[model samples]
Target: MPTTPRIADERHRYILEMLQEHGSCKVAELARTLAVSEMTIHRDLAHLARQNLLRKVHGGAVLRNYIELTFQDRAVQNHEAKVAVAQRAQSLVRPGTSLYLSPGSTTHEFALALIQDDLQIYTNSLPTATALARSAPQGLRVTLLGGELVVFVEALVGPATEAALADLRLTHAFIAVTGVSLEGGLTLYTEEEARVIRAVIRAARKTVLLTDASKFGQLVGPQVGHLEDVHVIVSDHIPDAYRQRCEQHDVEILLTADLDVMPTSAPGAAAADRRN
Candidate 1:
């Protein structure tokens, strides 16, 4: 028999794989097959769902197809670089201030860094909300927008989410994108997500984009906003040519490598250190 912790871990891993292969599965059946309690299976499902790994449905969980990469697949891609970008983005937040967070792995890491501050955060990303809820600093206030839950990306979009955002104002907005083109502007995978991000840009006093070097010069989808709308571009690296292009639009670019020393010794410290 597997130890309790090992069993729990295996069950979670199995559930993720099962969802990937079968699309979805029933809770009761999974529990029976694994020889675990239904309650344990439910808890595991909730944890995976919070990570945006899968979506909980009527009787079980379903694979979120909108994700461009599998959760496990993303765990290894430029992870060190993304963490650095996230750290750089984290320094921008002051304690006791409110901010808006968008969906994406980089932004998700940014959300993790903010968990230790007293902040009022508004976001449509289920993963961001869950991270904040579970690990946020004392006195943190998080508001999740009500809308149609997009299982694939674990983000809230559509008319209802957009409507909810229209009523709120923010001190800063940290947005992540699939690509940032010098000529094409900020692009995303989904138009609906792009629309919500644009709304966030309009609602916030300062807008910062958190992206790694690899995202530069690539065009993914429709434009969400332009360099002109952003107060600063926080990235791990901004090539001289791209820096010049951003400057042309009156956007200030902050490179992670140029920042002062950081307190945390995390792998991405160089990028996170540049925020302030």
Candidate 2:
């Protein structure tokens, strides 16, 4: 049967979400959800499998060993949410402060939001360095850690990078991660990158984990650091469970992103009917 006309990119994203939410989704269900034929759903699954984003099974598709999205793809994944998180992080950034920008999609967006000058920006991400070059409204000092670049991750890691940041001091370090589990603490995929981030955290007087709502409650890969190691967490959504854990650890949680303004009618519609 022929698949209905659907945006290829959108369908892939939707399928990914469906799988994540359900843990596994059958082709028939996915087809119904997307209003496409089984053949189209199979094709979508095949493409995502090649990207290592999922594993195709007999009946349908299941999650892979990890989520291996490229930096560029992840950057646009939840763009507005990232921007809102970036703005919240900006409130903590003052002129003349030194920031250790770690490698991640959210941190890259944070780099884009940075506008102050007379500040020092240190990072290992190629995109973060490039973004700061363009958007720093004032004269800024940028430092790139010396290391062999991880092309896929678009950042520097390994011994050279760690050594370079050894003596450096930072006012703040914006840490990006794959998941946050109460038992596992802060976690990311690669051990090398995890060690580098921990070093950056040690150098900073304050550490703020910049992440989105999606990362909450996920437990994956290596444990980067303990919850108490961080001072603050800025995310789009902080669930009550997470809020309780953060409070227990003495970690401040800041929810700064307002959701999209999708009103059924004109503005102020909700307030119109509600009178005292």
Best by TM-score: 2
- Tens-digit lDDT track of model 1 for 1-276: 534777778888998777554455679999899988788788888988898877776567765555465333554678888888888777677887789988888878887876456789998888889989888888999999888777667888989988887887787889988777666678776567777998887677778888889888775544676656676788878877877765555556666786752222332233233322
For each candidate, give its TM-score against the true structure: 0.67, 0.69
**Per-residue CA lDDT of candidate 2, range 190-240, in tens?**
667777988887788778889988887775545578666777788888888
Q: Which stretches of model 2 miss by more than 4 angstroms?
A: 1-64, 257-276
Worst 10-residue lDDT window for candidate 2 reads 267-276
User: For each candidate, C-alpha RMSD in Å?
Assistant: 15.8, 14.4
Measured by C-alpha RMSD in angstroms, how accurate is candidate 2?
Answer: 14.4
Residue pairs in collision within model 2: none
Question: How much is the lDDT of residue 29 in candidate 2?
Answer: 85
